[model samples]
Target: MSDIATFARVKRPVVSTWRRRHPDFPAAVSANSGRPLFDGAQVTDWLIATGLGNAAPQELRSELALFGIIALRNRFTPWQLVETLGSLLCLRRLDGRPLADDGANASPTSPPDAEADEALWSALLRRAERIDAEDDFVLRELRAIDATAAPLARLAEDLVESAYDERGAYEWLLAARSRLGLDSLAADAVTPELRSLLTQLTDLGVRLERGESLTLADPHVRVGDLLAALLDDAEDRDRVTVLAADPDDRLTRITRRRFLLAGVSELDLDVQTGSDLEERFADPYLAGPDGPAPSSD
Candidate 1:
């Protein structure tokens, strides 16, 4: 924390204040004798993107473009490294390809640092474009961070390796929603006890249905956290289908990724964005043009 204060040219308490007040602050990665140690890269990304520190605009400027430092010097950006890396995990899951060829094939957790930053970024983005040709999940985010791709890509790799799978990685990333300033998505991010209660209620509902399938729907699904938490560790994932929608396009895409990576088949998931609804293109179950017959989530 003191180190962060020193780098940001702020008093020690200011850093603490940022941590306490800002839900999107990068969390401490570990602790040394009780002093929390944060990931320097994540901190740097946060400061640069948020324009929080005393660092100048030029110092934080990305190679592609300036991140709105001059006019909105202290402006907070909605873009978070966690969000970008979350998309990358979705891309990797979609492709089933390692984001890097440098020992990633041999080891899922330990990505090599042999390649240059530019080369590694290019290679990973090529893979991203190949998988997400429609720019649905990752292409935009990956391309936007050319300057910080080196650290962020390594971070993404570390996330996948440590979490064991794409679904786990995504859940872990979303767990940092407060730090990433996406607290709005966590409207139902309740206490563990409450989450357990919700799961129990859902289980009871399923039981009342006599082993029938469930069609859970959220009209404004934000990254699918509420639904995902309810369905976590449930044995009926295969039998459960989800119909989710959100006014935010990015959130809808991320929600779709969250469920898809959590073993929800494409046919079992239907997520519509704001535009989809504006055009009346969303069918509830996607069974036909009329959705489910007198049924919906």
Candidate 2:
């Protein structure tokens, strides 16, 4: 890992020190709820504008506030949820292929097409890998209960940021192809049933890349499968949220309205118009009454 990557992954130990050294950092990122107009409505509006939706805003705020507890629970792990932001910040250094000079005694001129492909693919793959890696916490938590769909759904929404660029679209296609290859390779090494399962996953990815829904096979769905389908499409995640949310009239109308207006769906909506949304998008395995609960020792 690079120095910055290492720092981000291991920054918890220095939290207190960093806070003392740079107290302004938190205030910069933190929303002061006590301030006027920075209350629930404003916050929810902001999240909605940013594509996060209100979906349990209060719950999210509370959960965020309990960062210390979450850190302790996970042994102070640094969550790198989508490294795209980081990669974008460091794009000049990380987004392109290195030029080799004097190959066979002379540097070969790079094709513009190939150059474009390399630049785009490098950025996308790095971003996706970072996302999957940083989401290790969500994966581990879900695996404990054999439930991975919720986290996959949430990740799909975040993958929306990649949809605006043409390069991002092609790069996402490349990711799907690579993941398909990995699944195929794994299938070749496993038993017949496992092979069949892996093949199904491969097919799901292919279908998703083609802009089709694979929710019919969601029980057998994996995060890799969802990522393949949703990365290049802005509306993919919103559709998932709509379907995953209750199929109620109200939700359906709101989801449809959002889709028609903004081309995306917001999952965490308020009960009425002024309610505080909870953190309902997680794998639910960690919060459900019948699911694993945080231990109180």
Candidate 3:
């Protein structure tokens, strides 16, 4: 209900009033414990019928995607959700080969089949293992939940085709975490204005390089926002080397997945998860060949 309210930009009371007064309002299709879960498609249809579909298509899709994520959260822990979502994005970045043999069989279009579901889960587990074995636990949890893949796959596909690039998708996920009241460590996420400022600073740094190759490092990489900003503005991407470190393993995985989805070549990237302070001081990449540390300012 809160998700719907947020999407419609109305107070929660307004959503309650609609549910109480409207005879044709969509009913909850399922429940988690005692809380009812409404189908996003049904709710969207109701919005369209009530002349309340004024939200932009992109916003609507994002809202629905967030709703689906919340549904998953009801069954999984916060870390599990993050790990699974990151793995899915990574699989997508790998050309969707892990979802199905042809990369087309595992979609919302296909009706749910027991055999197909098993096959999809098997493929996903294998792919997740290849990316990071630690994520296998989350994949197993995901497989145990029936009806997980269809909605997730649909949401992933929408996100891949959406106008927002990988960085935008990461921001959207952080926003969803806050809006959904999910337990998260998203306070460290970079704001849009700050991201823009960082990108501009990277441009200045590139100019200061005087046409030489640019090497960038972020010791406290929260979702790789600064690194991404630098990469986005670099004209000679092949000449750019990015070194980033973060303490959060899940965040580091998400950042790596986002970077891959952004088409950043692995040769130019070195990301690790550990004590940011330790990595900052010990990482050789942070120092230039001239034996001087670069100014972070």
Candidate 4:
């Protein structure tokens, strides 16, 4: 009931009214610990049939994908889901490839079945392990998800297609987190007003740089919003380099992915996970005895 209410953006009583008034409404499919559970697919279909399909198909798909993710939270922590989803989105943006290659190319005409699902999970885990090996934080989160008996890889598969664009995926994931009572996941999310201010600051920086090369750095790079704005307004973007760091590894990775999606080349970017204060003072790019003096702005 709560899930339906959240998805429909309505009150619980409104859902109850629909159940009481609609003759063709779908019934509960099963029960969990005395609580009835309805089939999301059936509910969605009924919603579309009853002139309640205000959400775009893409939005609906993303919402359903989030439902699948939240259902796995009992088996895996919400952070694990966030990390896995972020990695999948990053992989997609970097290349036109799925997180897992199920050898579907080996036999293009083969029908999809249980065997394919198994192969897909295996491939995805293998790739996730590779990523974990490089980043300690990601590795720890992936291990937690792997320890679970639940089929978590399926959640990534369901979400990958709907989250092809980085910015939209980032915002949708934030919304999903809020809906799932996981507001902490987006504690550092940039607000619209902050985004606007960042854009204006970037524009000012670009205007000041003029023809000279500019090196912009954001010590607390949340979602790369500042860097994205800077690049967007830069007239000589090729000469601009971004140095960004955040304490949160997941957010750092997300910032990197967003920058890549924004068409910032790898050579022009330096993103890392660390304390903003330490990064600002100790890093040569930001501030060092032999390096350029850091800007107060």
Residues 215-291 of candidate 4 have per-residue lDDT tens digits of: 66777776665456556565456666667777887778767766655655667767878864333323332331233
The better-scoring model by lDDT among 1 and 4 is 1
TM-score of each predicted structure versus truth = 0.60, 0.19, 0.67, 0.68
The global Cα lDDT (0 to 1) of model 4 is: 0.60
Q: Which residue window of length 10 is worst by lDDT in model 3?
A: 281-290
List pairs with backbone clashes in candidate 3. Answer: none
Best by lDDT: 1
How far out, in Å, is residue 242 in model 4? 3.2
Task: Give the poorly placed runs of model 2, Cα more than 4 Å off.
Answer: 1-13, 20-247, 254-297
Candidate 1 residues 140-234, lDDT tens each? 77777663345455455655665667787677666656645656765646578866866775573454346666666666566776677766846
* Steric clash pairs (candidate 2): 55-268, 56-277, 56-278, 57-277
| Candidate 2 displacement at residue 120 in angstroms | 37
Largest TM-score belongs to which candidate?
4
**Candidates ranked by lDDT:** 1, 4, 3, 2
Model 1 misplaced regions, further than 4 Å: 1-78, 102-115, 186-188, 204-211, 275-297
**For model 2, how does the per-residue alpha-carbon lDDT over 47-101 read when each residue is reduced to its tens digit?**
4354332234333332222221222223212222122222221221222221111
Whole-model alpha-carbon lDDT for candidate 2 = 0.28
In candidate 1, the residue pairs with backbone N, CA or C atoms under 3 Å apart (3 or more residues apart, or in different chains) clash, namely 23-178, 23-179, 24-179, 24-180, 24-181
